[model samples]
Target: MVDQQTPVGANAPTRSGGAPALRERLTRRKPVEKLVAETQGAEGAGLRRHMGFWQLAMIGIGATLGTGIFVVLGEAVPVAGPAVVLAFVLAGVTALFSALAYAEMAGMIPASGSAYSYSYATMGEFMAWVCGWCLMLTYGVSVAAVGVGWGQYINELLHLTTGLSMPAAMLAGPLEGGLINVPAAIVVLLSMFALLVGVRESSRVNAVMVAIKIAILVMFVAIAVTAVQDGNFAPFMPMGMAGVSAAGATLFFSYIGFDSASTASEEAKNPQRDLPRAIMFSMILVTALYCLVAFTAVGALNWADFADGETSLAGILTAVTGTTVWAVIFAAGAVLALASVVLVVLYSQTRILYAMSRDGLIPKAFSTLDAKGTPRANTIITSVLIALLAALIPLGPLADATAIGTLFAFALVNVAVLVLRRSRPDLKRAFRMPGAPVTPVLGVLSCAYLMFSMALSVWVAFLAWLAVGLVIYFSYSMRRSALEHEDTVEVRS
Candidate 1:
């Protein structure tokens, strides 16, 4: 029932005639109007639209709330001191602009691929490939980073529950003085299994994990409240505005998964209405939670105490209560919570690749879904590669790459919003970014600022990756793209 005209093979009427045809196709953007039609008309299509507002919001919350606070706090707090509280607010505001752009686009497109699909529809095949490549790096590297974080928590939980721990050699990748992160790889494989079973099943599991994680954080706030000291918050902005901005740049990782709701647009029961609500609600909820935790943690202990990346939050609880019980509970919650993060991040990765595949930008095998409407082959392939990275790579470098890649994609979504508004003013939008061009313009500027704050080494690595993507685009994707052929035919006729 997916408007047969918009099916995967619909655009493959015939190959473009020659070089002119190919060039035209490559540069020709899929009209936003047509793509919107395909999505609106494809209801009884393959993918099930079973997700409601609550389920969709949980997907965003479950993915966004995990590693950022539990792990990255250690790294960010020391940079900004107690002003890290303002850092969270700054990062959330920056993320809010992009999130508004995403909401508007989601209402109009209502498809997978998040920014990539929006770009393909409004920008062109070439730009679409670029967005897809950025997304692949963002989600792919994020999975590895989350997995490694989970490994640290696993070690903490093990040492707490039983008086035994994995040897340091078995606990981290070689870059971190360990043989391999075996626990990280194990968790990725487990998430892969859950996804393969079904989306609804995975959704349920993600919701439950989110509930438990919120409960754990709530417990921390309650206990940490009793121990709050006025002196701890004195001299809050010790590092000044520059440090606050830098910490905000780093803490941007915590806000990455708020767009998970947008990715599920294709699976929403009433995407136009529910998708926007889900995205907006999730963003507000997450921003509030992040601020509360930041304020409470800093109030309960000196910012200097959070310098250790692995055990900062748990250590704070232990120091405050004079008991190991709270720390143990926190560690156990981290272990479970980061697992759900893996599941959702990996899920986003596969779905983006699947959308690109369906568009003929990648191999169809990557997009081919089973009877249950899950991308089984795609999930397995992504899991294998991610597991290897988690097992072999260091967390610091992987985290840097993910953040930069995501910022690049966020900038483009804002651009897409600007483009679509001009090209399709009549397009019905369930939600619109307030202040129009100003909001998206600010989104682009803010994302670029954060990207500039990244280490020079990260910029070098991101450029090298983009260089490789161009080669793939020119050599392979150029000739095989149906968008090219479809556009060429329209122009010729």
Candidate 2:
């Protein structure tokens, strides 16, 4: 039989000679200095660094704007009543802290994995594994939820435009009294094909889609503001502080996609400079849009009038305009916009898995690039998994689970920024968080608090998923990790 060892680098040490003990292997961290050097070396880093600040910012906006304003507002408004506007502001503050931390890390690492790469370089391998596992779950589930939102908008648009609509049995998952969500599955497949083609193509398409959605939102706000009733402002705090806080926790999901820009660090032309700008610019821009939409929508009608998951925004437009025309246009815009959300979320998932595979945490096949420099295997695997989930699962509970998983990752990123600053003060950073330890501390605390706001079942689901990740890490990844092999060789040599 051909020796499997022959294909490995001749210098790589084997277990027979001696490898890192299991405990050490799991705890060892990647040096920040080494990570920077490897990135600079340009050794077989297959992705093309073609994105500019504008492209990166557009990607962030595309990823962030769609899911929250278009779908989430319906659920959030009912919880916080008219005070949901304040909830958007609250959520934006939490997002800003995490975004600032991400900016510093992206400027320092400028690689594909986002928080996972940052944690690996600053913290230990085990922390990195946990962060990567959380992100994998968050992005995967978020994409599925976005797909369902797109499906809902498509149905609304069709009923308005052609007097035709999908059957209820075919419009949702079995958990929602339907067999499957066909439109959700369709959007996932469409986005998958776009990714397989290339990042440049997908990103360009996403930018155009983002512009259209923004215009649609601007139009909605303008019309809704005109119809605002003064009495809608009087009892705005009907649900009080507890409701607003809970709503803020839910709205935080809208900001989840801001890190999607950081995940493209390898693909940015000037990652050290452009990534920080993209991260900050996208968060500020999306936050402004969310607050405007929330303020206008609630003012136009009482908060109690907003229905959960019933095409809330479009219904408001139709009711106010005394016609379905504006609603049709709004629904069409949502379909276009949410498709971009799915694309960006799926893109982030494939890249994160690719980074992990390159480290030998999963399998190298996932990191193998096609001629276009894309990890086609990883993309295909992610596409299939997300598509199945979007088709078979209900959206509401899935969204809550996504929130907790993402919060866990955000907290880790905040910690990574703090740890790296202390460990390697000499490393050059293109951007720094304003308050250093203070900002990062708040980032950690806010994320922890929001995570606690989730339902007990959501916490249960997140813990169960983490349990699975630990089993895989110990059984398969601990044996194959490339870092352990490299360390073993250096010690033996």
Candidate 3:
């Protein structure tokens, strides 16, 4: 067995007892600060940073408007009734606070791995590893879950419009007592290929899907508002404030995908200048759009009849139009929108893993970039794991688990903003969060409140995941940490 211990001052040549294991103490900055510098300087090895505030907004809409709205209606509407509209506003406000905090961090750190990199720079190694690990749960597997959802809606659309007779087992997810969901698996593979091709290419396709999605929602609202019945909202707070808060927890998931935009800081045209703008702008746009859709949706249908699963929006349109045409079109738009989200989110997860591997925190294999500068090895492995999980489990658990991992990251980032402000006040910030203490405090409290409202089972699952992370960190990460050296240190003073 190899001994991992280092003598005191192991990295300092000036130390008495041991020759400097000079590389160890210096480990602190390279994986943390150096990577930070690398992203700002040289990370655009493949794709050019050409996105603007508008493109960033579209990316936000593309990611957030998909899965939760399409799938969550069945879950949230029943719980809060017409008050689900208020729930959307409540969740939007909570997420907006966190997003503002994130924008501030992105301006300062401007790294490729979003919250993980920020944690490393401010909180040090242990928390960074945990954040990165939880991030995998948040993003890596979410793509698989959304892909399965897209498959269901697509199959239904085909049946409703094309009159194709598809078998239940072929179309149904594995969790639904089916052997395999061929369409879901197929979509995952297709998305993997697109991601492998390149981000620029993916973004082009993403842009088109985003436009369609926005159009579909606008069309839904325009028609729905015309059909509003005041009767539907007589008992607006049917389930009361508690129900709104509870549903707000899940609806918060719809607001989260904006963070992925910040992860592209490495590929941003001007990170310190534009990354913060992009992130905040995206958050604001999505929040307004969600509020609009929620208000219109509750007014278009009786709150009691919204538990129609994937058909909630469609059903409302059908009831109002006295035809299925608009509903089917809306569902089809949803499928395309969700598909883009799954692909982009999966790409974000793999890239984050690749970043960690490059720091030697994980196996070096994970960081290997193909000729195209895509992290093929990491992407494939993560996809396979996500596919298996999605095949066997339902979306509720997967979504809640993702929320837990994400909120944990959010709390760390909120705290990190404070750490960096105090520790590196001299660092130039292109963007700033006003009322520093209040912003971060509210951010943490809001995230924590939502996290608690989730099912107890989610809490247990999160604990189990944390246990696994600790085991890995103690067993291998501590020993291999680039910062393990006892001697060398970088100091500003």
Candidate 4:
């Protein structure tokens, strides 16, 4: 390992020929010791350490459990039929492979940038920027996607209880025949308020909501199980293996939040120990819940009925009980569940930007924190932009874009693990992934396969997004990056 006090760009070769200098700048790696040191020094001072193991676990659970199970399942089931259950398993397994890679990386590096930080320490400055850019797509757009679902369930709850609904013009985006998704925008702003208050306060609210959502899901399973028809699952693979793969690609959006815990590395009480456990524990709990809910849901209501909207689980409860009472309760739970997703994913988005800002890759405003140890400016800016996205875009396109970005970032993290293992074997890791080289290799292959399974349009959109990121990198971030200077960069107040 490199010395903790080493200057960030101290090892770079001086003023080489044009192409060589550019190559060195792109491939320049930040030392792991410096990565850890920044968190203990002025750069990480504004973030408070308040989260313990369970609170960290709740971060992961709060983010992961909601959107997929509560919202996206409705979208996924119609694509995969009863085999949506298999889709859940496939997505979970792919996530598990990356989760293992995350565990090892989090234990070793422990930074707020998550995979971006890991890449900076192992791959280089340019790859780190690419990873951070993809994460922005993953966390930011996923918040919009979940917020869209929140609006749907809000309408479901209103219809069951008050016999009314939000105006059609306010219920969906223009693409979905509505002028704006008012409820989705509202939910994102509400979550933004919670985050601005402080992470500790936001996390306590998240913990309570996480518990409520899990209980509601368990209740759903118990009630729906009694109504299961063996015949509903008769033609299980209606769309066949291709459908299963496509649904699996779509459903990967649900697994996005499990890694949100890793982003809290700077705020964690015992990051090395707690982060790994939180990442793994949350993945296991979420996978089990997803499988159970998908199985019971298909068995009770038939996969075809899941196209109803974001209220699929509540719809199942109502169908089984033959009344709207339980459906109302389920819808209420879903509102709380999806709101938690917005809070956590939005929180992660700010932290990733904060890390980038501290490295001079972006403006210093994002790194500025208020007295409450919260990134007030970052929170406000991110929420407003996400609110507009949620209001203007429909859920399906938002989700596919998020899934591809997330898978691409995960692939890089796996590669980072392989790189670090070879280059810095002496670094101590609190949690070493069991399978080592083979596991991370599988992680890379699995993520690539899922990304390949996405629609052609999704690939085009993803490539376009990457192109924009490259343009920003070459035009702005490259010249401003901390690695281009010799002085130690400090976070702005």
Candidate 5:
């Protein structure tokens, strides 16, 4: 556990006497000791710490393993050919580099804001706000993306089990000629209800769903391997390295939830020790599962057949088994899998907003807790907004935005680790990332490379979102920040 009584700003740099007020405010750093002390003081008034190591690991796995293997392979395999397997490896490698950085920071800080809190302690308030803003995009949009994918699998399962499909008008958004994706919105609400009950309850539900999804994937590998064709390996690199890189960028969406455990730091019984272990363990396990499934998936069917994003792993199962039984089973698992993603990611989003709200960077309503120690208002408001997005937006755009936002946040995390190591070397860390400066530098470079591989349209969309965030920050957040008041008090005293 962190030493909660360390004085605020004990190791923080003294402000330069000649610095301008505006510059000082913009670059003001929140000491890690202060963060930990606040958390300790909140005790019963804040989120309850009920999660153990396995639950945290399950959060990571449940959040990560869903959308990629079940939904994204269709989008990625056509781009990378049979070498989509390599794309999974590439994306996993990128996530691994950042995961190491996240583990180190989680051990030292153990806060709910994840990278955003780390940024506050190291990069100052302005950057922390930016990182938290990006995280809002990452987790909020990702829930919608995963929810949309869940609706597709629900459609597949309905078709396989009952020989009937949902009305197309109700199954997709306007872009797909539907009025609204009702099932997608419905799943988001279901996950919200799970979270409203409490984090402990949500974690239990996620653990069960995570187990089911993993078993389903393992079943897929077993059934698909029997149907493997050496011929599928022949034209593996048909699209070449460019295709591979592009697919890696797309597939990076699959690894988005691997760091979700870090967001649960405040709710973990032993965050410093368990949080780091959960992060590293979950990433390694998720990467292995991704590589295995991707290899088997490409081997089982021709890569060109994956163009239909809605019918992904289930289609493969149906084709291989020559029956709807296994495909139906897989589709059912997929529904549960994607629901778990929505649940965990929604939890992460609420926590990030809670941290920001506590800092007065957003409305205090976001930080309000119910009798169960759940952020009830925050959960409902976030879920309603995200559900609207899921109901109205197309999955493709939602996913691309999520990928870009997640990569940007992750890059900041790597930078945070470097900044903190140099600024506060005396802080105890239960875990340390090896090859320090070199490793984090590579993490940043890899995230940038993947971001660049995305289409220009994605970049445009990301910038537009950031522009909106900047406007909010300047107009409201900066003036209302709790740090501003704290600074004033110190000067007066």
Candidate 6:
């Protein structure tokens, strides 16, 4: 697809599908020795590269294992029936293809900015802004969404263990008839402050949550498998194909942090090499956990009960094990794990805003750094906004926006991989997407299909978000853009 709008001489790349042109490039006589212009060296971009396998693995786990495994199980199982296990696989498969694309692109760029950076290097500024806008909303709103879900789990854990219960309205949000969730708001603030301190500290914190979350999930799988009566799995695919699609669309929330792993290219020790490893490695683990968790939930209870239940995983576990321990573990895991999601995701979001601010897209304050070498101003502002939104807004609307926006970014990044591969053959890539052009093509299509499957209301909300992004871009970003000023240079390797 030749983007007619794409400008030339500026050298925007064309997307490939392993077609004639792609084959021609691959069959070239020499690889980078077929070099066109750039010089050879270990590094070019100013980014400090020191990320190792441990950090990479931690990031992968941090991003992939989260609210999805903890919450989406209820949303997915109720809709997909016992086949919710399959939906986990389905979403994973779709995500895998795109992650492969991300692996390739991350290897090529190896920048801390994530998808927004890749889009700028390959698709040019306009598309980059679009992607950047989508990413900002994707991670930004998710900070609040996860915070909201976290509040519920905290309430559940308190009531389950100590028999202390908060009013239903307070546990929920103001829009849902609750005043506010102080704990959830605190979690958001805590996560923001953690990031504001530094990535190393934040990663350490995420590691702890990862352990707790996995332990809780392991217990659920063990307990649920033991109680599998075979009767609960009977109504497989009860809602039919439409329901399956809806489940896929709804379950999109679980897959949120897959890309967050790749956003840390600057700090990555061998980023080009380890970045791709972390992305795919983490997805594989997340998919297995999600499938097991969902299968167990469906096996433990009647699917219809999930549709009407106030508490998702907690209710399913209570019904399945005929005890509240499972609920306690699940709730406890959610409470512990959500901090990981919020920390890593807000970290990624701030990095992206830092990039955009460095490029003059938004206010410079977003990229402002304190003595800790962290974005204190940006993190604080982001936390406050997320805290307010989590305190006041309803979950359903926030979830919808996050799902649709994230899927859109996924599809675009997939295509952007192809564009970069074809046009910049000289660029070095540490990790490669399997099937080359074919995989990315399928990735784009799959993601787009999922995006469209969302409700009409979601589309309206997306448009509204994009509209605001566009207004910011045109009125402030475009004019103040470092690119236009010629004072700014792209920080790509």
RMSD (Å) of each candidate, 1 decimal? 4.1, 4.9, 4.6, 3.5, 3.8, 6.9
Angstrom error at residue 117, model 5: 0.5
lDDT string for model 4 (299-407, tens) is: 9987767665453788888879999889998999999989999999999999999999988898899999898778899999999999999999988999999999999
Candidate 6 per-residue C-alpha lDDT over 321-438 given as tens digits, one digit per residue, 9 for 90 to 100: 6888778868877788887888888888877887778667789897666654577787888788888887877666787799888888888889877876786666677777879789
In order of lDDT, best first, we have 4, 5, 2, 1, 3, 6
Q: Estimate each model's TM-score.
A: 0.93, 0.94, 0.90, 0.95, 0.95, 0.88
Q: Backbone collision count in every prediction?
A: 1, 0, 1, 0, 0, 4
Q: Residue 460 of candidate 5: its Cα lDDT?
A: 99
Off by more than 4 A, model 3: 1-33, 40-55, 163-165, 171-174, 308-310, 485-493
Question: What TM-score does candidate 5 get on C-alpha atoms?
Answer: 0.95
Worst 10 residues of 1 by lDDT: 1-10
Candidate number of the best lDDT: 4
Model 6 C-alpha lDDT versus the unseen true structure: 0.73
What's the distance in Å from true for residue 344, model 2? 1.0
Residue 187 Cα positional deviation in candidate 5, in Å, after optimal superposition? 0.4
lDDT of 1 at 243: 86
lDDT of 1 by residue, 96-213 (tens): 9999999999888888778998888766678889999999998888889899889888887787779798898877888887788998899999999999999999999999999989
Candidate 6 residue runs with Cα over 4 Å from true position: 1-50, 309-311, 487-493
Worst 10 contiguous positions by lDDT, candidate 2: 1-10
